[model samples]
Target: MTIERAVPAFAGFMILLSVALTHWVSPYFVWLTVFVGANLFQFAFTKFCPAALVFKVTELKSAGQS
Candidate 1:
Protein backbone atom coordinates (compact mmCIF):
# COMPACT_ATOMS: atom_id res chain seq x y z
CA MET A 1 0.00 0.00 0.00
CA THR A 2 1.03 3.59 -0.48
CA ILE A 3 2.48 5.50 2.45
CA GLU A 4 -0.63 7.65 2.58
CA ARG A 5 -2.72 4.54 3.28
CA ALA A 6 -0.16 2.61 5.27
CA VAL A 7 0.42 5.40 7.74
CA PRO A 8 -3.12 5.51 9.10
CA ALA A 9 -3.53 1.77 8.78
CA PHE A 10 -0.41 1.35 10.87
CA ALA A 11 -1.63 3.85 13.43
CA GLY A 12 -5.04 2.22 13.72
CA PHE A 13 -3.52 -1.22 13.95
CA MET A 14 -1.12 -0.09 16.64
CA ILE A 15 -3.89 1.52 18.63
CA LEU A 16 -6.00 -1.63 18.50
CA LEU A 17 -3.04 -3.87 19.22
CA SER A 18 -2.04 -1.77 22.18
CA VAL A 19 -5.54 -1.92 23.57
CA ALA A 20 -5.60 -5.67 23.19
CA LEU A 21 -2.23 -6.00 24.83
CA THR A 22 -3.34 -3.81 27.68
CA HIS A 23 -6.38 -6.01 28.22
CA TRP A 24 -4.82 -9.41 27.71
CA VAL A 25 -1.17 -8.80 28.38
CA SER A 26 -0.24 -5.88 30.64
CA PRO A 27 -1.45 -2.49 31.71
CA TYR A 28 1.85 -1.04 30.52
CA PHE A 29 0.66 -1.51 26.98
CA VAL A 30 -1.61 1.47 27.43
CA TRP A 31 1.50 3.57 27.21
CA LEU A 32 1.90 2.37 23.67
CA THR A 33 -1.51 3.70 22.78
CA VAL A 34 -0.63 6.99 24.39
CA PHE A 35 2.62 7.10 22.52
CA VAL A 36 0.89 6.50 19.22
CA GLY A 37 -1.65 9.20 19.99
CA ALA A 38 1.09 11.60 20.98
CA ASN A 39 3.01 10.90 17.80
CA LEU A 40 -0.09 11.50 15.71
CA PHE A 41 -0.70 14.75 17.54
CA GLN A 42 2.88 15.82 16.96
CA PHE A 43 2.68 14.96 13.28
CA ALA A 44 -0.21 17.39 12.83
CA PHE A 45 2.14 20.25 13.64
CA THR A 46 5.51 18.89 12.57
CA LYS A 47 4.40 17.29 9.29
CA PHE A 48 6.85 14.54 10.03
CA CYS A 49 6.20 10.88 10.76
CA PRO A 50 8.86 8.25 11.30
CA ALA A 51 6.59 5.65 9.72
CA ALA A 52 6.20 7.84 6.69
CA LEU A 53 9.94 8.14 6.47
CA VAL A 54 10.34 4.41 6.61
CA PHE A 55 7.63 3.94 4.02
CA LYS A 56 9.36 6.47 1.78
CA VAL A 57 12.66 4.67 2.08
CA THR A 58 10.84 1.52 1.05
CA GLU A 59 9.50 3.35 -2.01
CA LEU A 60 5.86 3.66 -0.98
CA LYS A 61 4.52 6.70 -2.72
CA SER A 62 2.48 9.38 -1.00
CA ALA A 63 -1.09 10.06 -2.17
CA GLY A 64 -0.18 12.38 -5.01
CA GLN A 65 3.46 11.49 -5.40
CA SER A 66 2.61 8.63 -7.72
Candidate 2:
Protein backbone atom coordinates (compact mmCIF):
# COMPACT_ATOMS: atom_id res chain seq x y z
CA MET A 1 0.00 0.00 0.00
CA THR A 2 0.99 3.62 -0.45
CA ILE A 3 2.31 5.79 2.33
CA GLU A 4 -0.89 7.78 2.59
CA ARG A 5 -2.96 4.68 3.17
CA ALA A 6 -0.39 2.83 5.23
CA VAL A 7 -0.06 5.58 7.81
CA PRO A 8 -3.72 5.58 8.86
CA ALA A 9 -3.91 1.79 8.58
CA PHE A 10 -0.97 1.45 10.96
CA ALA A 11 -2.50 4.02 13.31
CA GLY A 12 -5.77 2.13 13.38
CA PHE A 13 -3.94 -1.10 14.07
CA MET A 14 -2.05 0.54 16.89
CA ILE A 15 -5.27 1.88 18.43
CA LEU A 16 -6.96 -1.51 18.34
CA LEU A 17 -3.85 -3.19 19.70
CA SER A 18 -3.62 -0.69 22.51
CA VAL A 19 -7.28 -1.17 23.38
CA ALA A 20 -6.82 -4.93 23.49
CA LEU A 21 -3.75 -4.59 25.64
CA THR A 22 -5.62 -2.31 28.01
CA HIS A 23 -8.43 -4.83 28.27
CA TRP A 24 -6.32 -7.96 28.67
CA VAL A 25 -3.10 -6.69 30.14
CA SER A 26 -2.81 -3.36 31.89
CA PRO A 27 -4.91 -0.25 32.07
CA TYR A 28 -1.78 1.75 31.31
CA PHE A 29 -2.07 0.57 27.73
CA VAL A 30 -4.96 2.94 27.31
CA TRP A 31 -2.40 5.71 27.34
CA LEU A 32 -1.14 4.26 24.06
CA THR A 33 -4.53 4.71 22.48
CA VAL A 34 -4.69 8.23 23.82
CA PHE A 35 -1.28 8.98 22.42
CA VAL A 36 -2.22 7.63 19.02
CA GLY A 37 -5.40 9.66 19.00
CA ALA A 38 -3.49 12.78 19.97
CA ASN A 39 -1.02 12.24 17.20
CA LEU A 40 -3.79 11.82 14.69
CA PHE A 41 -5.45 14.98 15.88
CA GLN A 42 -2.28 16.98 15.57
CA PHE A 43 -1.45 15.40 12.25
CA ALA A 44 -4.69 16.65 10.80
CA PHE A 45 -3.32 20.19 10.88
CA THR A 46 0.43 19.63 10.95
CA LYS A 47 0.51 16.82 8.44
CA PHE A 48 3.68 15.67 10.11
CA CYS A 49 3.25 11.96 10.52
CA PRO A 50 6.28 9.99 11.62
CA ALA A 51 4.82 6.81 10.22
CA ALA A 52 4.50 8.50 6.85
CA LEU A 53 8.17 9.41 6.99
CA VAL A 54 9.08 5.81 7.75
CA PHE A 55 6.93 4.60 4.89
CA LYS A 56 8.56 7.16 2.61
CA VAL A 57 11.92 5.59 3.37
CA THR A 58 10.47 2.35 2.13
CA GLU A 59 9.55 4.15 -1.15
CA LEU A 60 5.82 3.91 -0.80
CA LYS A 61 3.78 6.25 -2.94
CA SER A 62 1.21 8.73 -1.63
CA ALA A 63 -2.47 8.66 -2.53
CA GLY A 64 -3.14 8.61 -6.29
CA GLN A 65 0.56 8.12 -6.82
CA SER A 66 2.06 5.39 -8.99
Candidate 3:
Protein backbone atom coordinates (compact mmCIF):
# COMPACT_ATOMS: atom_id res chain seq x y z
CA MET A 1 0.00 0.00 0.00
CA THR A 2 1.00 3.61 -0.42
CA ILE A 3 2.54 5.66 2.36
CA GLU A 4 -0.62 7.76 2.56
CA ARG A 5 -2.53 4.70 3.61
CA ALA A 6 0.20 3.08 5.69
CA VAL A 7 0.62 5.99 8.09
CA PRO A 8 -2.91 5.94 9.43
CA ALA A 9 -2.99 2.18 9.57
CA PHE A 10 0.28 2.12 11.46
CA ALA A 11 -0.98 4.74 13.90
CA GLY A 12 -4.22 2.90 14.51
CA PHE A 13 -2.42 -0.38 14.95
CA MET A 14 -0.02 1.20 17.41
CA ILE A 15 -2.91 2.60 19.42
CA LEU A 16 -4.72 -0.71 19.51
CA LEU A 17 -1.55 -2.55 20.44
CA SER A 18 -0.85 -0.08 23.21
CA VAL A 19 -4.32 -0.49 24.60
CA ALA A 20 -4.06 -4.23 24.50
CA LEU A 21 -0.71 -4.14 26.25
CA THR A 22 -1.99 -1.83 28.95
CA HIS A 23 -4.83 -4.21 29.71
CA TRP A 24 -3.06 -7.51 29.32
CA VAL A 25 0.63 -6.83 29.76
CA SER A 26 1.87 -3.80 31.64
CA PRO A 27 0.97 -0.20 32.33
CA TYR A 28 4.28 0.87 30.84
CA PHE A 29 2.91 0.12 27.40
CA VAL A 30 0.58 3.08 27.83
CA TRP A 31 3.67 5.25 27.48
CA LEU A 32 3.92 4.08 23.89
CA THR A 33 0.44 5.43 23.28
CA VAL A 34 1.49 8.77 24.65
CA PHE A 35 4.63 8.85 22.53
CA VAL A 36 2.86 7.88 19.33
CA GLY A 37 0.02 10.32 20.01
CA ALA A 38 2.44 13.16 20.63
CA ASN A 39 4.35 12.42 17.44
CA LEU A 40 1.18 12.36 15.38
CA PHE A 41 -0.04 15.56 16.99
CA GLN A 42 3.25 17.30 16.32
CA PHE A 43 3.24 16.07 12.74
CA ALA A 44 -0.23 17.52 12.26
CA PHE A 45 0.87 20.92 13.48
CA THR A 46 4.25 20.93 11.73
CA LYS A 47 3.10 19.21 8.51
CA PHE A 48 6.28 17.15 8.83
CA CYS A 49 5.60 13.49 9.22
CA PRO A 50 8.41 10.95 9.50
CA ALA A 51 6.45 8.27 7.72
CA ALA A 52 5.94 10.60 4.79
CA LEU A 53 9.64 11.28 4.64
CA VAL A 54 10.33 7.57 4.60
CA PHE A 55 7.82 7.18 1.82
CA LYS A 56 9.37 9.95 -0.22
CA VAL A 57 12.84 8.47 0.15
CA THR A 58 11.64 5.04 -0.87
CA GLU A 59 9.81 6.46 -3.84
CA LEU A 60 12.85 8.42 -4.94
CA LYS A 61 15.10 5.38 -4.85
CA SER A 62 12.57 3.27 -6.74
CA ALA A 63 12.08 5.97 -9.37
CA GLY A 64 15.83 6.30 -9.87
CA GLN A 65 15.99 2.66 -10.92
CA SER A 66 13.79 3.12 -14.00
Query: Top model by TM-score, which number?
Result: 1
Give a tens-digit lDDT track for model 3, residues 33-65: 998899899988897778668777777333334
Which ranges of candidate 3 are over 4 A from the true structure? 55-66
Alpha-carbon shift of residue 53 in model 1 (angstroms): 0.8
* Ranked by TM-score, top first: 1, 2, 3
lDDT of 1 by residue, 1-66 (tens): 789799999999999999999999999999999999999999999989998998889998878875
**Candidate 2: what lDDT?**
0.93
Among residues 3 or more apart in sequence or in different chains, the pairs in candidate 3 whose N, CA or C atoms overlap within 3 Å are none
Q: 1 or 3, which is superior by lDDT?
A: 1
Off by over 4 Å in 2: none
Quote model 1's TM-score.
0.92
TM-score of each: 0.92, 0.91, 0.74
Candidate 2 residue lDDT tens string, 1-66 = 888789999999999999999999999999999999999999999989988889999999888776
Better of 2 and 3 by TM-score: 2
RMSD of each: 0.9, 1.1, 4.0
